[model samples]
Every structure is written in structure tokens, then in C-alpha cells.
Target: MVKQFVRQKARNITPTQFIVFTYLTAVMVAALLLLLPASVKEGKSISFLDALFTATSAVSVTGLTVVNTSETFSGFGALMIMGMIQFGGIGIMALGTFLWLIFGQNISLSYRRLIMVDQNRSSLSGLVYLIRSLLLLALLFEGVGAVLIGSYLLAAGYYDSVPMAFYHGLFHAISSYTNAGFDLFGDSLQSFSNDYVLQGLTMVLLVLGAIGFPVLIELREKLVKKTPNFKFSLFTKVTVTTFVTLIILGTVGIWIVESSVYYREMPWHQQLAYSLFNSISTRSGGLATMDVSEFTSPTQFMLSVLMFIGASPSSVGGGIRTTTFAVIVLTLVNYALGRSEVRVFRRTLKQEDITKSFVVFSAAVMIVILSIMLLDALERQHFSLIKIVFEVCSAFGTSGLSTGITSELSAPGKVLIILLMFMGRVGILTLLFMFRSKVTKDRYHYPKEELIIG
Candidate 1:
């Protein structure tokens, strides 16, 4: 009877609720797996809470760790974390759907709805095709990335043995492509600071991972299949434009603030490299060429802002997302120019899209501010406010970049960060919708009123 009730309830749950539960289940299972003795190093032990936190971080693709990943996790544990990163990067729903297809099981409407919500799709058309392409592309990119980086490491004598070199390469490749900031390298990409070739490859993979899948699909269509007269959607245009614009602004912004301070005596080339790589990573890459704690407070705040904006929608990373940020900016521009509606790329934006954008932005601001306040209250005595703020934004954005204070936080602080990471991964909109009723609507409308404009 109990089993029947659960089966019945599962069938009737809303897509949003189902998504939450699915991700939650994944986190719990991963946490339990991490708690096993085989998953830890010979002398290291892990508490359930720390395991949960690490699991959440891994499944969210957020790299914030309560323990040193390299020192704590055994080889099996590291491999498990990599698997979780891949699973989280592609999504649990995508993986389940892929398995179903493999077994030649039919994908029903219910399955499609889950996929739509998981991938943040607006429509239900061609979902099966999308999953197939996603899996295929993931393989192609990861395979090529591992070979290039691993082979380079071996040839460059970074690793004496072939297996170890390729294993490390494969791990880093998955992490980079998934925007999963977890690293086997103790200092992230810091040891490779002067290795332009590795840095360049990693950045390319990061961008590809965070840039929305829709844009990638369309690009693949045009570039690979040579689709004739292919036109880009408004979403792709806005997303790409905002994404590129932010990278430029972030790079320039970092350079500007650092020029008179940290980079005062540094050469121009090194300065550019640091500025550019940090800018890109700030937007969800999480990998770093240098210690971010060395930067001025202003620069750290700047990095926080980019993390809050985050990667493009339908991608691995999180925040309010690039489109949401773009919509808010465009709306302000339209109003300032005496226009009524947001317009871009020769197309007018829908009213619903604009409203939803504001909703996301407002909710994100509220959540982020509250989390920062709460963390400040808890840990301000031990850490700087700027560091706390950066950490909070990092959790919410799922960027995983930290100021070396992650492991030192109080128990409550770590829990708060874990919740923030979960929220960041599943999204603010999802959380909001989880409480909304699916069966109820107002039968009659009240008279509308307008307040004085700001």
C-alpha cells in the first residue's frame, strides 16, 4: 500500500516538483556514496554533512569545497566526483532519457516534460533529437579535450607515466567542459599560469560549456551540416551579444582597477593574460590563473558581479543567466530612449519575457542579498565582509571561486553555503514555482491600478 501511494504520487507530481526531487535525490545518493570508506583517502575521514556539502557542490557543478579535494578524497572518490560532475553537467534527466533510448523504451509525454524543464526548453519539439546531439557532442568535446591536454602533459614531462597523465587530463577536461570548477590540481589552474596552451584550451572549453545549448545546436547546424540560409534566433543573438559584451567589459574592468594597484609594475602581456582569464572564469569557469584573494576589494567586488550575472541559460552554469541580465538592460535602454517595449536584433521582445526577466533578476537580488547578510552575521568575525560577499555570490552563481575561507566557515555557514549552492543550481525560478499551485487560477480579475513611476 505504501509503495502504491509513492508510485501514484510520483506519477502526479508537477514537472517543476519532479525536477527538484530528481536533483535532490541525485545529491543525496551522491552524498551517501561519498561517505563510504572506499571513497576517502587512507587516513582521512568525512562527516555526513561535509559529504553532503561536497556532493551538493559536485552535483551543482559548484566547486566550493569544505575540505581540500586532493588531500581528502581517494582515487576512487575523485573518480566518483568526476562522474557526478559529468552527470550534473549534462543533467540527471538527460542521463535517464539517454538510458531509456538505449534500452529502446519509448519516451512518453511525461518524460518529454521533464526534459523540457531540465534543459529549460520553451517548447517540446524535437527533444529526443536534442538529447542525442547533446550526448554526442559531449563525447566529442571531452574526448578531444582529454587527448590534447593529457598528451601535452605527458610530452611536456609533467607526468612520467601515460596512464596518470591521461587520467589527470581526462579529469580536467570534464571539469572544464562542464564548468564544474572542482579540480584535482591542488591550486586549480594556478600551476599552469604560464602555460598559455593549456590556459587557452581550458578557456575555450569553459565558454563552450557555459554558452547556451540552443546557440550551440544552431551553430552545429550551420557549421557542420551546412544548413542554407540559416537564421539565428533572437535568443541566440541576445545571449551571444551579452555574453561577449560582458567578457570584454569584465576584462577591461579588471585591468582598470588593477592597473594602479596589483599590476602597477607587471608587464603588459602578463597583465592582459591575468585580466582576460580571470574575467572569463568569473562568469562561471571558476578556474583561476592566480590567487583571487590577492586582488583589491574593488576587483573582488567586480568579480562577484560577473558571477551573479553568470553563464547563459540552458547551460551548465547558473545565476540570473545572460538572457535575464540582457532583458533587464534592454528594457532600461528602451525606456530611456522613449520607447515602450524592449527591442533588439530587429525584433520586438514579448511582454511575458520582459516580465519574467525582471522577476528572475529581482528574486536573485533578494536571495543573494539575504544569503550574504546571513553569512556575514555568522562569519564576519573571522573573515572579511568582501570575502564573505564573494563566497555568497559564488555559491548562488555556482561559480565555486573562493577566497580561501571555504573550509574555515562555521557549521552554520557551511550549511548556508550548501543551500545557496542548491538554489543556484536548480535556479530561483524553479524554487518560486515549486510553491505555486498547478490546479488553481483566479475566476475573475480585479481592476488594475498603476502607481507613480520611479
Candidate 2:
């Protein structure tokens, strides 16, 4: 039976392998569904490369579409994309666990291990509860978002009928809260650029999604249970602090860099709205209110930096992660100060954590640089270097914000971006681990040697 074979295969592979396999499977399935005749508009067939690219983007929850989602895909196709977003956003294992619980099936030890790795938990304890809580919270947040957005759209006559408005609202609600960034609006919310209610709601949903599920869980517990004298975990503190700091800095940075060029004719409120939305969107939200190309080169470069840093770990978004960036900075600061240890919040970090942070950061930079180089060679004549770099970073960070070069990319360029999106979703470290050789104990120690380094 298929179930027996799957169980056997699952037993033979590590959790990391299983996770990668799950995403690949999801991508393939989504691609096939997207290629279906019903999935596309009448009489139009999707190209294999574009279909695969869109599927990968949706399954990875990265919104870098090679085709215009609203015009190219039918309602059924759009729903299929939404399904992939949900699967990728919350993860396939989490959804599987929820179904297993609903069916009254026992979650085996191996299944628990999969869940642990999927959610980035260190232990197996309370994983079922965690899944239930995660799903419930996701539904609640997304449901409220849908209602609010739908009501506003209908009241404002954005759509002709209630059903159409509701569908768009629901689609955007899921997309925003999952940080999937796919949009039904042709220009990706440009019409609503000055609409404070929609933008504010979207920003909040994006933050909640990108802040990591564990942090949300902790916040829920603290706020709902009213825990007395409660303190947040170090992870929560570091992630929140870094996330907020980046938003503030990015907003100000973009405003200062582009005020003279991009926003010179706009009012102060419109300027603020654009800056804030773009800042948050660059951090893996990807739903832009305006064309990214309108900004100056310096502003585009800064947005690229924001996208490269991305969102928090164990969340829907990608990039090197907030904590990793924070650790790298802290490590440098301490080293410059000649300190014995890198400490944050009066707590000393483990040597392994520091090493891992550096590895992740360095590896990410290498991947982005290499990707940019490849893209430049492929599309240099067609696009500017800054646009190429921005696209590469968007793919790597899974940020999905583009300067209008996505559709113009050649076949090879699309494939490269597809690979970057996959790597981003699976994570640099996870991908490295997937190819890492098995460790073996040595019977004897090698002679120690010292090498000079900067």
C-alpha cells in the first residue's frame, strides 16, 4: 500500500531530508495543478517554466511571480495558489498533524519528530498542543483580518458585489497574515496606497506572521493567562528588538534616501505611508504599494539590505534571520571591545551559537553574491545591476518585491531564482545540513596548527 511504503521511506530518512522532500513534493504538485487548463484563463496555457516558478514561489510562500497572478490565473488557479501559501506558511507537517488529530489518529514518535523539526522546536514535549494552538491562532487572526478587509472593501465599493469583495478580502487576508505576499490587485495595492485602514491592518498582520510562531504563542499565553511577573525568552526579546529596530531604521533610511527624488511631489502623510509599508514589505511581506523602480538607486540598495535580513526564524519568511543578524553584530561589538564573551541581556551566549550565527550569515552572503553574479551574466543587458541584485536578494530573502524584471528574466534566470527561493525557504543551514557528510569519530587527534588571520 502507498501508506506502508511512505512509512518505510520516512523511517529511512532524517527529518531534515523529510522536510526538504515535503517542500519539493508540494512544489511539484502545485505546479501540476497550476498547469491544468482550468487553472489558467480561457484558451491560455501557462508555460512550464512560469508555472513551475509560480508554484515554487507560492509553496515557499515567496511571492516572486513570473506571471501576473490576477490576469493569468483563473479563480480556481488563484485558490490553488492560496492553498500552497497556507501549506507553506504554516508548514505541511503542522497541517498534517492537525488532520491526524481531527481523525483521532495517534501521532507516532516519528511523526512527533517531524513536527519538532518542522516547527523548529528543540524537544517533542507538547508538540501536539502546539500544533493545535498554532492552527487555531492562525485561523483566528486570518478570519478577523478577512472580515475587516472584506467589510471595508464592500463599503468602499472596491468591488461590484459582496461575493467578489469578500473573495478578494479573504485572499489578501490569508496572503498578508501568512507573509505570502501574493496579491489579486493587479498593481499590488497601489490603489490602496493612501488608504490607512488597509495598510495598517496589513502591516499588523505581516508583523504577527513574521515574528515567529513561538513568539506569538508566548505573547498569547502572557496576555490571555495574565501571567504574573512573566518574562519573555531570550529568543523573543532578541527577535522583537531586532525586528522593530530594523523597521524603524528601514523606514527612516528609505525616507531620507528617497525624499528628494521619489516623494518630492507627495504629501507628508503619503510619504510616511509609502516608507512604512515598503519597510515592512521588504522584511518578507512583499506586498508593495508602488513600483520599487520608482525609488532612487540608494533606496533600492537599502531595500535590498532589508530583504536580505528578512524575517525571524521559524516563521513564514526567509533570509539569515533576525537573531542571526543580531548575534553577528553583537559578536563583532564584543570582539572590538576585547570582551571575553558575547553577552546579551546579562546572559552569555554559547560558543556554538556564535559560530552557527557566523556560519549562517557568511553562507547567506556567499549565496546572494553568487546568485547576483549569475543573474548579472544572464540578464545584464536587459536589467541594471541594482535591479539584478535586488531581484536576487528578494528571491533569497523570499521577499518577492521586484523592480519589474521578473517577467523579463530568461529561462535560466527564472530557474536560478527558483532555486534561491527554495534555498531561502529551506534555510541556508538546513540546505547545508542536507548535503553534509555523516560524522565519524576519530581514534587519534591530529597535531595542532595555527594560521594567521585578520
Candidate 3:
């Protein structure tokens, strides 16, 4: 039976399924490894459920910790979590490809097809070259970020040991770049709110990570090939424009609402930095230099919206995705203008693309609703419903921001969050597609019927 199962799987498995399975398998393994006595600093073993929860959060790169990451886990455990984040960011398949590259193994045609689809590459022909470029780009950016952040932290006298400071820099740099929202600082970067240097470096990391892998690869190709005539694809243009617009709008909105309270305490330059960081982080990065819970009601509402929009397609961060958001907006504009085509940059958007956007959007909203209801049922608290919804959305979007209520959640509440993290990371559309099969219809004519709407 086992041999039969393996043979059947071999015949049917796709690379995307393999990638997803690899991540889920890693999550389970990491959970068990983390529960070991050596993983905890005080040598206390973690419960199965707690281990599973932590592993899911880290592997999903959601950053919602059931236990205090900084205090509960030993250095070895922290490194394990960091490894999970890196794997989650580039994807398990991509990591496997990286290993193959290091070993100088030629990428087979099948592997190339998988990489192209999984990474959302435009063309499958140069898949191996693209994968190599992506790995090099990631390393270079991460290396620079680690150095600058490490130097700043050392200058600030934040750590006594050189290795500690370096590790802290390396941890947060990778964490931020991956949009994992995990921090060596237990308070999650709040200690550096007033520190301008750290804040700026972090912002850069967030932006780079939020942009999808495809965009990064394209940008790198332009730089290396020196193709001055290289044009941005419509998808890239829309994603960049939408992301920038959202950041700007979120920054301005947060500034206006929270400036008198949160920003008033800091100098003008620092206030701008704080506002910008929160705006970028809100869209699924979840790193907050300031205490986001202390923000005014309006500011929290704004953050909820940003978190819902989240990051771009095939990026480290999650949400319905920036491209989905752009499609929805474009569709709306086309409708208002009475145009048949949802065109942008002189390119007509595909009907399938718009339909998929609606499906993704609907699935996301439904998940948020269902999660909020479940949390309310589990917690049995009198907390504001809006805040709970925000938390649910954050988890499902893999944003990891909270109103400082994650630790207070009951066991069932934590479980709910774990499920949400998995759903968000795997993505609602991907999940749907996994269970759905393509259907074929005959050419025979059927009786035409029309239904009235609205």
C-alpha cells in the first residue's frame, strides 16, 4: 500500500504541490525540534500544541508567538526560527533550487518549469539563471542590511558582546527582509522608536521584501544587462504604483490621527520616521518601532485597512495581494467610465484575472469574518469586536500586528490563530485551486436562461 501510494503520488504531484507540502512538513518538524529540552533556555520542554503553534507561526512567517520568543527560546531555538523564516520567505522549493545550484547540479527541464510557475517567472527558458540571480540578490541585500544595522546597534551601546550585537542585527535584518515580524528585542523594535538609524534601515528592508520576487529579478536584470530600454510590465507598474500609493496614504492618515498622541512625544524627524515605518509595516511586515496599540481609534482603523491590502503577489508578505487590490480598483474604474476593457498602461487586463481577483477578495473577506467569529466564541471577553476583526485580518494576511492581545488569548483562541496563519500563508486562492479540478463541457447547446440582478 505504501509503495502504491508513492507511485500514485509520483504520477500526479506538481511542483507547486511539492513546494507547499515541503513547507508544511518543515513546520511539523520544526515544532517537534523546538519542543526539545535544549530549545528552551531554562530547559523546560514545551507542550505539543504550543510547539505546533510556534512552528506554524514561524514557518508561515506570521510572527504571532504563543510564547515569548526572546525569553522562552534558547539561542539554538532562535536560529531554528530564523531558518524557518528564510525558508518561508524564498519558499521551500526555491531553497531546494539554491542547494542544487551550490552543488553545481544542472536544473532539469521539469525543475525549471516548476521554478517558473512557483516563483511567477515570466518565462521558463531562463529559470535556472533567474533562480541564481534571485539567490545572489537576496544574499547581497541581507548582507548589507545586517552590516548597517549591526554597526548602528553597536554604536548605540545596545549590546555588550560583539557576537550578540551581530546576531541581533542579523536576526532582525533577515526577519524584516522576510516580513516575518520576529524580533530579537522582546518588545519587537519598540525600544528603537526614537532611534533614527535603526528605523530607516528597517524601512528599507520592509520595502524590498514587500516587492514580489518577479519585480526584484526584473530590476536586477536591468541593472546587470544595462538595458536602458527595459520597460516595466503592466503588472509591475500597477503593483509599484499601488504599493507606493497605499504607503503614502497610510502614512498621511496615521500621521494626522496619531501625530498629536504618538508622534507628539518624538521630534519631527523621528515622528516622520515612525509614521513611515508603521505605514510600511502595517501592510504585512508587522514590525512596529512604536507602540501601535497606543495609537488612536482612527489610526487603528487605518492600519486594519492597510493590513488587509498587505503585500504583492509571490512576495514574502501576504494578503489578497497588491495585484489583486489593483485589479479590483481598475475594474471599478472601468465600470464607472463605461469601458469594456479594464485597461491600464494601454494594456487590457484579462477577464480571468479580474474574475480571480473577485474570488480572492471574497475568500479573504469570508475568512476574516469566520475567524473573528471563532475568536469571539473562544475568548469569551468583552473586547471591542473591531479590534478582534483587525487581529483576525492581521493573522489571515500574515501581517502579525496586534492590539497587544495575542498573549491573553485562550488555548482555543491560539489554535484559531494557527489555522488562520496556515490559511493566509498557503493563500485562499491556492487552497481553493488545490481542491478544485478543471471541468470540461460538451459543445451541445442548452436552453438559454437569464436571471435578473439587483
Candidate 4:
């Protein structure tokens, strides 16, 4: 009877659900392990809530923290956090498949499809081979970043010894590249805002991570081995164009808004560096050198816009994605130009993608609105509606930027943020798929009627 019951429970779970459940469970278990006496400083243990919160933040690749990361976690704990960042930054499935590749085991068709779909790979054929290449690319970029940043840190005397400097370099490099935004720096890079080397390396890491894996694969195939007639996928083109556009706009917006106010005393070079870093990081990488809360109201509003857009699809970062944002912009542009089709680069986008963009936009907005309502109720008179909305959007988009409201949130508000993070990471569509209703085709069609004119 027990065996039968267990079998039934297993039967009820789908592959997709299993993927999400496995990741969540693994993150929770790792968090718990990190909270163990051996993993923390002074042999201090973490409360259940604190452990769960930190674990969620790390696993979601969201940088929100309820406790001080540098103080609360020991060397062992830091390593665990680093592992979480690596796993969370790279989809768990990719890691699983990579491990399988190392063992010379063949991945099943179902698993390959999952990777292909989740990573938005160009093709499902030879997925195992692709996995190996993807893993190599990830390691290569991350390693180079670590070395570059470590060399700089060593020169700057950021740490006491070579080992410590190397470790920190590896940690931040992986974190930044994966868009995990986890920082070993006690103050989260606030002291390095004007440091040219640090800013340049971080920007490099962020761009590499935010550019989808498919782009990297294509670039590798074309540039490295001299593939014939290499063509960049539409996804790649859109992702890069959208990403660059947003960054340029966001940087300019920050520079203009904060120039005379928050950055008044800083040199122009430092101001531009800080502005661009914050602008890119706001999209997905959560590391902040400047005090985000110190931004003027207009700059804060601009950041909220960037964070809402988030990172590109299937990339380490999260958001509605650059492609989705591009679709929305294209749609608006087409409407303004009195054109029915949203054409770009000599090609017309499919109606399905346009519809998907609207759905994602709507879902994200609804979640943010609902979170704001809940936070408003819980915090009473403590925070403004705009502040609450910004915080909630940051959590939901997994952007992790805040207006000094994260640590001050009540229990209920924190829980709301947690839900938002989970929803943002897994996506609203995936959540809906879990509860999707069965559908049947209908032969009959209702008469068309116009309901409204705007």
C-alpha cells in the first residue's frame, strides 16, 4: 500500500514541475546546510526564516538579503553561497547535463528538449554536444573575468593575501557573469564606484551574461572554427540591440538626473562610470557601488523602468526580457506609423511573439500591482506607494535594486517579496501551466462583435 501511494504521488508530478521542485529543494537544503554551525562565524546558527530567505535570494539569483552576508556567513558558508550563485546563475538543468556529459552518459531526448527550450537553444539536435560547449564557454568567460578582476584587486590591496583575493575574484566574477549579483564585498561594491578597472570588468561580465547563450554559441561557431555562411538568429539580434539601447538610454537618463544632485561633487569620468554600471546592473546584476536610495526621484523612476524590463530571455538575468521589450516597442512604433506589421531588419515578427510580449507585460504589471497593495497594507504608514512599487518590482523582476525598503519590510511584506522572486524566476506562464485547465476544440464559432473603440 505504501509503495502504491508513493508511485501515485510520483505519477502526479510532471517533468516541468519536477525541474522546478528539484531546484527549490536543492537551494533550500543548501541554505540549511550553510546555516549549520560549521558554516557560520562564531558557530552561530541561523533561524529557520533567515536561512530560508537567504537561500531563496541566492537560489533565485536575486541579491536581496535579510541578514548581513559578510558578517553572518563564515568561509564555508561563503563557499556554499558561491555554489548557489553558480547553480542559480546557470540553470540547474544545464549543470545536471554538464555533469552527465563528464560521466560520458547520454542525455535522454526529453531532457535535451528541456534544455533546448529553457535555454532557447537554436536546435535540439546534438544537444549533449551543445551542453559541453556551453559549459566550456561559461567557464572560459568566468575564469577570464576572475583572473582580470583578481589581478586588479591584488594591485589595489583589496584583500590581505593572494588566496583571499583570488577567491573573491572568482566569487564576484561568477556572480556578476551569471547575473547572480552576489558580492563578497561587505558593502556590495559601494567603495569601487569610481574604480575604472572594477567598473570595466563588471560591465564586461554583465554584457556577456545578459547576451543569451545562443548568441555565444553562434559567435563561437562562426568566429572560432570558420563556419560557412554563419547567420545570427533573430533572437540574438533582437536581444543585443534591445540590450544596448536600454543601457545607453538608462545611462544617459542617470547622468542627466543625478549630475547636479547626487553626483554633484564627483568627477565627470567617475560619474559616467557609476551611471553606466548602475544602469546595466539595474537590468539584472544587482551589485551597486552608488547608494541606489540616494538617487533623485527622477533617477529612481528611471531605474524602476530599467529593472522592470530586466534581462534577456534564457539568459542568467530575469525580467520580461529585452526581446519582449523590443516587441512592445516595435508594436508601439508600428501603431504610430500606421502599419499593421511590426517589421524590423527586413523581417516581420510573428503575431504569436507579439501576443506573448503583451501577456508577459500584463502578468508582470499585475504581479507588481498586487505586491504593492499587499505591501501597502502590511507597512501601514511607513513607506510611500512609489517606494513600495519600486521595491516590489525589483523583487519580482529579480533585479534586486532597492530604495532602502527591503530590510525594513515587515514579515508579510518580505513573504510577498519572496513570492514575487519565485514568480519572476520561474515565470508567470510556468506558474499558470501548473494549474492549467484542460481544453477541447470547439467546432462552433460565435458571431464576431465589436465591444469597444479607443
Task: Kindly list the per-residue Cα lDDT of model 4 for residues 1-454, writing each as its tens digit.
Answer: 9999999998777655766687678767976887689778994667776777778778888888877788889899999988887887787788999888779887887788667645645367867766677788889999999998888899897876888888889999998898876787877888886687898899899888877776788888888987898787787788889989999999999999888998899988888888889889999888888788888777887888888888888778777788988999999999999998999988899997899789889888887777778899998699887788778778877877777777788777777887777777776556655665555789899999988868
- TM-score of each model, paired residue for residue: 0.98, 0.96, 0.94, 0.94
Q: What is the descending lDDT order?
A: 1, 2, 3, 4
lDDT of each: 0.92, 0.92, 0.83, 0.81
Q: Please provide, for model 3 over 197-285, each residue's C-alpha lDDT reduced to its tens digit, 9 standing for 90 to 100.
A: 88889888888988876688777657777678898778778888999999999888888887788778777787688788889998988
Prediction 2 TM-score vs. true: 0.96
Number of clashing residue pairs in every model?
0, 0, 0, 0
- Residue 278 alpha-carbon offset, candidate 4, angstroms: 0.8
State the weakest 10-residue window (summed lDDT) of model 2. 430-439
Runs of candidate 3 with Cα error greater than 4 angstroms are 14-16, 43-45, 120-125, 260-267, 439-448
| Candidate 1, poorest ten consecutive residues by summed lDDT | 433-442
Provide the global lDDT of candidate 1 against the true structure.
0.92
Candidate 2, residue 386: lDDT = 99
Quick one: best TM-score, which candidate? 1
